[model samples]
Target: MDAPFSMYGPDFPFAYDHWLKHPEGLGRIPVNRHGAKVAIIGAGIAGLVCGYELMRMGLRPVFYESGQLGGRLRSASFEGAEHMIAELGGMRFPTSSRSFYHYLDLMNLKTAPFPNPLTPAAGSTVIELEGERFYAKTLSDLPPIFQEVAQAYDSALEEGAHFSSLQAAIQRRDPNAIKAIWNPLVKAWDERTFYDFITTSKAFRHLSFRHREIFGQVGFGTGGWDSDFSNTMLEILRVNVTACDTDQHLVIGGVEQLPKRLWSHEPEDLSYWPNGTSLQKLNQGAPRPGAAKLFRDPEGLYVTDRRGHTDRFDAIVCTCQSWLLTTAIDTQESLFSQPLWMALDRTRYMQSAKTFVMVDRPFWKDRHPETGEDLMSMTLTDRLTRGTYLFDHGPDQPGVMCLSYSWMSDALKVLPLDAEKRTELALSALSKIYPDVDIKSHIRSNPITVSWENDPNFLGAFKGALPGHYRYNHRMYGHFMQQTLSPDHKGVFLAGDDISWTPAWAEGAVQTALNAVWGVMNHFGGQSSLANPGPGDVYPVWGPIDLDELS
Candidate 1:
C-alpha cells in the first residue's frame, strides 16, 4: 500500500548524512572516555540496535536485559502444538521504515507477504450506539450526524494537500463551505474516538446529521486498528538483513539473534555478567564522592528489577515503557529533577490488549447462508469491551481459527486476569461476535490470552501520546548526548526507542542505535559514510578494549 503522504518529500525534509555525524558535532556535550566498555540496559529493539551500532563503531557494549530480549515483540506458545507466535505487545510494522530496511539488509532476513483479507474474508463493520447495531459502510450508511462529518472529512482531504492544510482551510472560514471540518478530524486524531470529538468540539455543532456520518465512515474506512506503520519496517528488515534468518521467527530465537550476532564475540574475551555485577561497576565509577554524590554524577544511571536487584550504569539507554520509568523514579529526587528525565516522565501512553483464541474448527470459512458471504466480521466498536476486532487465521491451519480481541484503555484496566479466568472472560466475549458458536466448549478445550499488564518488564504494549501531551512536547524522547565528568564518560552514551523521533516501534529502536553510533563516531573524530560494507568492514573484528587497567 502507498503511504498516505511522502515523509521524505521536500515539505518534510530530513537530513540523513547530517544525522549520521557525531552528536558532539551538533554542539552537544560529549561523554567522558573511561575505558572503551559501554553498558546498555534493556535488550529490546532499541538496546539491541544501539549495541549493534556501538560494536560496529569499535566500542564494546555489554547489554543487560532483566528479562528476555525483544521486550515488546514477544510471542507465546499453544498447548504443546506447533508454537504459534502471538504478538503480546506490538503486532504489525509499516512500510516507511527506510533505515529499518537498511538494517534488515545488513542483518539478512526474509519476508512473508501478509495475506490481504480485502476479498475472501472482507467483513462489514457495525457500530453499537444507543443499544442498536448500525451497519457502517458508506458515509450515507451511518447515523445522520456521522454522515455529515464524513462528507466534511472527504471535502477537507480533497481540497487540502494535507490534514494540516485542511485544518488551515477550516480556520479561514471559507464562505463557500457548508460546515467546519478541522474540529472533528483533530479531535478524532487526538482522542482516538470520533464520538468524543463530535460531542466536545463546538465547530461540529453546525454539521448536519448526514455530515456527521462521514466521521464514522472515514474512521473505519480501510485500515482497521491492528494495522500499524511499523509492519513495513519489519518487512524491510526481513528482506535486507543477511545475518537475520527467517526460519527462526520466534522472538526468543530470531529477534534475540540480532544482539547475539552484533555481540558475536569469542567466549574467552567476553565477561558475562548474568546477574548485577556489571551494574555495580557502573555505580563505582560514578563521578561524585558520596551516596548523594551518586546522583550528581553525570554518568549516574540505574536499572532495577521488581525482584530487588538494582544496578547502575555509566550511560544508560532505557527503551522500556515511559510510565515505568516515571513511576520507578518518582520517589528518587535526583533522577526526576533532571530536565530530560522530567520531560520523559510527563509523557503519556495509550493502553491496549490482544487476545488469542484457538477454536475447534475454522468457523470463519463457513458462509452465512442468508447473506451468501463469509459469516466472520471485524468491527471497530464503541469503547464498551476489550475484544473489539475479529479476523481469521488463514489457510496454513485448516480447522483452527484465531481471534484477536483488542480494546484500548478500558480493557487495560481489567487485564492480566489469571489464565483460567481470562479464558472464561474471552470466551464469554467471543460469543458476542460469533453468537452461534459453542464458545464455552471451544474455550474450555483450548484458550489463551496475552495481558501486557502482567508483563513485568513491559507495563503496557506501546507508547501512545495522551490527549494534549503531543502539543507540549515535540521530540518524543531526548535526542542528544550529555557530558559526563568521568574519563570513561566519553565512550559511554545512551540509545533507545524512547529517545528518538519515532518512538514505540522497531524503526525507532534502529534509528536510536544509528544515532548513538554516529554520536560516538563524531565524538571520536571518525568519518561518516553511507557505503554498504560487509560485517568485517563495518564492525571491528578485534575483541573489546581492556577494562582491568581503568578499574
Candidate 2:
C-alpha cells in the first residue's frame, strides 16, 4: 500500500516534510526573535517536537515534565532482557502517519511490521468466542460466517462512506473530488456513533446481529473495536480512511527512541544556537522541574515549578493531556475562556491496560504435536483476555509476550491487580485456550504491567471522542488561531493529540505541535517565507468544511 500523504483526509493531506518544504515551513524565524524564551509543558512527542522545531528556528524553548519523558510513547523492558521491550503506550505506526514518519525517518529507526490479526506479520491468528475456537492463517481460512461479516463491513464503508473514492482523491490530490466525497461524509457521520453506523448502514443492517458481534470481536485492523462502538463515527472513519489502524510497523528496541534522540540531536545551520547545540545542551542535561502552576503575570506569562521556582516566558505551549489543566496544575481562572475550558475538561479518555512477561525464549514457536502448528498464535478471544500478542527479539534473546491487552471494561477488571496478579490472571486465561500446554513454565523474569488509567500523570490512555463531540474538537483545534482572546489568554497555546482532528495517533500529536509552533512564531512576529507557506498560512483553503454549514 502507498503511504498516505495526509493526516486528516484529502483536504489536509500534505505530508509534514512536504508541507515544511514549502519555503513557508523550512522553518524560518525572524532575526530579532533569536533568543526569545518559550516554555513547553510536557516532554511527550508533542512537546518535544514543538521544542525541537522551535530550536531549529532559533528560539530558546524550555521544557517541563511532571512525570517521565515520552509521555504515552512509553516502553517497558524486563530486568535482564537487553533487546526485548513491552510497549506500554503507543506502539504501532501506520504507513499513513506521514507527519510522524518525518521524525521516524530522520531518526532512521528500524521497524518491523506489527502483528495485527490475520495480516501476514501476525503469522496466524486464533479467534475464540463462547467456547468455540476458529483458527485461520488468512481471512480465507475463516468460517463462511466470519468472512460474510468482513465483506459486509467493506461494503458499508464503500457504499455509506465513499471509502474508496476518498482514498483515490487523497492519492490524486484532486481538491474538487475530495471535497465532493469527504464533505458529504463529514455531514453524514459526524453526529452519529460507530454503533449507529453499524446498525443503520444498508449493508451492515442486512446482516444478522451475530455478524455484527463477530465483526466487533475481530475488527479489520488490530483487534476488537467494540470499545470504540460508542465513539463518534467520524472517529472511526478517521482511523480507517487514513489507514492508521492498518499496515502498521512497531519501532525496534522502543518507540521512545524517537523523542529521546530528538532531545540530544543537533541540527546543522541553526539560525541562532551554536551548530552543535541540542535541547539537552540548552537545558544543562536536565529539564527544569515539573510545572506546578501556570498563570499570567503583569509583564509576561509565568510558570511556577514544583519547587516554587518561577520563570517568565514570552509564550507557553501546553502539550500535556488537556485534563491536566484542571487536575494536575494550578491554572489561573483567567487563562482560558469558559468555552475553551469546557472543551479541555470534556475531552474523554479511554481506559487501557497491558501486562507483559519475559519468557526464556520464543516458546510459542514450538510446533504442536497433533496440528504441526505453533503451540500459540497471536490470539484474540471474547474471554477475559481480549488480545494476546507475542514479541520475538531473536532466537537467542529473551522474548516478550503481552499476556492480556484490553480496553475500557476489560481494562477496569485488572486495574486493581498488581503486576504478578495481572500476569497470573492472563496465564490462567490462556490455559483455557491451550489446555495441554504448560504456559507458565517458560517464565524468565518478573512480569511488567501498566494501567494507563491508574497513573496520575496520564489519567487515561488516550482521547476517544464521543458523539456530538465535533464542536468540542473544532474549538480545541482552532485555539491557535483564535484572535479575540483576552490578554491573559493570548500567549498560552494548546497542542496535543486530543486537540487535533484525529486523536490517539502520533501523527495527530506531530501535526498539532507544528500548528502550535506556527502560532508561537506568529505570536512573536515571525513569518513563513513567501515561497513556503506554513499550515496556518494555508489552513483555510485545505481544512475541513464546517459540518453545520453543510447540514
TM-score to native of every candidate shown: 0.63, 0.97
Candidates' lDDT values, in order? Answer: 0.42, 0.85
lDDT of 1 at 424: 60
Predicted candidate 2 versus true structure: per-residue lDDT over 328-403, tens digit per residue = 8999979898888988998999999998888988888888999888788899999878999988777887788899
538 Cα displacement, candidate 1 (Å): 22
Give the true-structure RMSD of model 2.
Answer: 1.7
Superposed by TM-score, candidate 1 places the C-alpha of residue 224 at a distance from the truth, in angstroms, of: 7.4
